[model samples]
Target: MNTVKIGWIGLGKMGIPMSQHLVKAGYPLNVYNRSKDKEDAFKAQGIGSAASPAELIQHTDVVFVMVSDDKAIDDIFTGENGLLKPEVSGRVIINMSTVSPAISKEMAAKCIAQGNHYLDAPVSGSVKQAEDAALVIMVGGDATAFEQVKPILEKLGKLAMLVGDTGAGNTAKLAINTLLGIVAQGLAETVTLARQNGIDAEALTTLLNNSALGSPLIKIKGEAIVNNNFNAAFALKYIAKDLRLAKDMGADTPLAQTAYKTYQDAEAALGEEDIIAVIKHLG
Candidate 1:
């Protein structure tokens, strides 16, 4: 099979490594980032760079976007230098951002109307999983389009599941993030309670990791909390955003609402820190 030409927009924490994976897989890749420094870095690595989304779409069969939020998504598709030009016809645009399901469906409709394919393929992983290409991708769009892009997605993730028609991927993503936020809050509160009662935080984490409650996230983020390492693997601000999206989805999300409040306070103080930094809010 011929290698599919790939174009990528957004070179944030996850996007950088994802695009690098495509380049490593020997696919012809072109990249565009709003930041010139990131675009220049891609150029240094011998990957091509485009001035705009429209420019990027012209050169590739598939375009992957991993922007920040719904507003950023809107800007990329409808901005002056957007990708919805006439030449985008027949191209596949896979949006891997975590946005509202409503926006995903609307964008999918627009892309289809313009004779292009759209996939709302949000991912489940942090910086480590992204770097290791171990993400679980939930994809929603045309089944044929999903099949066509499976190989490409596999280069960036361990598993890619086509959940349903357009917007389902984002719906699934929001659900997963809701659980993640709740778990993170639970872990944070547990750690704080332990620390306050004179128990060693790291020992508590070790105990948890050895217990039935242990999980990859608990072990990893629990360790981060114990060590007080608040680096941005998945920033608190982003998770707060996801929580808000989940709340707005019209579900009876009391637990998620509580977690949302916790994250919101954490984000106010340590927005740029990792989601694990929510523990800091307990003090």
Candidate 2:
């Protein structure tokens, strides 16, 4: 069993299952979530809970954060009773949240100055991939620190690669999510076009699945579109947020711009729904 004491600071849809892998791997883990119910849930499962991020870091060597956006990232690491508050040193703080590269760089600098290592290690894949430990993690930070926690990261994802320096993971994530928006929008428009021209949703999806252009995302989102199941696996709003972040990072291509606007327009109505629900906005 890897003996690095672990601390996890988020317990949302993705965070819960991702952290579970650590506990199951016997990493001597402790968790801290803003919601007491989630902490209680982990505690009930024989995992440990801490009252705050500061408290959690006191006893752990490696801390993983998987919150929502940049604001949440700010609050988690620098808010009241945050991780950097306790005068701790040598702790590897890995942020796996989908956030802006700028914020990740800011946090990395702060953590490094305080003698802690910070890695922007955001992941690609949704709740299902997280549950299955099949996520593709893109990491950025100190090489030594990455090698130190590689094994723990492996327990959470099928592939974990260090893409570059401090904010590179978030950069890669934004780029990937920008493509995700473009692809999802394309899929939504294709299904809409086929359905309008007398091709049944299932029939078109089947053809697409067998075609050379097919992919796991196309297959899965195609099924969701066929069944009209708009329930979120990856919420449309998050993708919209990512697109905006990408725009800020200079993703100014025609497809990127169009997809950003498409998702933004859909945000008001279908934002809470699955990203594939962009199809609904078409009508």
Candidate 3:
């Protein structure tokens, strides 16, 4: 077992499996979640749970956070009984949530002010990738802090790159999601066009997979479109949110602007469904 004890916060779709890798790696792991049932679920697995973020930090050296949005991130770090509630030092807090770069910078400053290190280490990939520990992690913060946690990060992601200092990971994630939105919109539009011309989705998807545009996303999302499986692996609303974040970051290209509006409009009814569900809106 590694000597550096580990703590985890926010056991959502991604967090649950990502933290499981650490426990499977034999690190003494502890966890906390706003909802008590998630903590109880871990407790059922014989892992310990903390009543609060501050309490969780009491027993662990490094903490990993993987929550939903900017507001959730803010509440986790600054709320009553939050991680920063107690004067803690020398601990590393790795935030893997997809939030704005501005919030990451704010939290990093707060953590550093109190003698702790913070890293904005958002990931690219959804539930399956997280479950398989094949996520691609983009990290930003102190290089030394990154190196200190690289081994641990490797257990959660296939690749972990230290991109830049504090909030760069969030920026890079937004940029990546911008392209992701465009691709999804492109794929949906192509399928819509093909169906309008009386082509089968499966046949079109097979040809596209065999063509120069072939990639894992195209294959998987194509299958989902063919089968009409709009399950929420990565929710549509999140891609909409990421596109909005990218727009706020000054992404105003023709495709960017169009894709943003397309996803945003689709989000009204399809927000809770899989991102590929945007295809349903087209039809």
Candidate 3 residue spans exceeding 4 A from truth: none
lDDT of each: 0.90, 0.92, 0.94
116-177 per-residue lDDT for model 1 (tens digits): 99999999998889999999999999999999999999998999999999989999999999
Each candidate structure's TM-score, on Cα atoms with residue i matched to residue i, is 0.97, 0.98, 0.98
Candidate 1 lowest-lDDT run of ten = 250-259
| 193-263: candidate 3 lDDT, tens digit per residue | 99999999999999999999999999999999999999999999999998888898899999999989989
Model 3 scores a TM of: 0.98
Question: What's model 1's lDDT at 189?
Answer: 90
What does the lDDT come to for candidate 3?
A: 0.94
Q: For all the candidates, what are their Cα RMSDs to the real structure?
A: 1.2, 0.9, 0.8
| lDDT, model 2 | 0.92
Cα lDDT of candidate 1 equals: 0.90
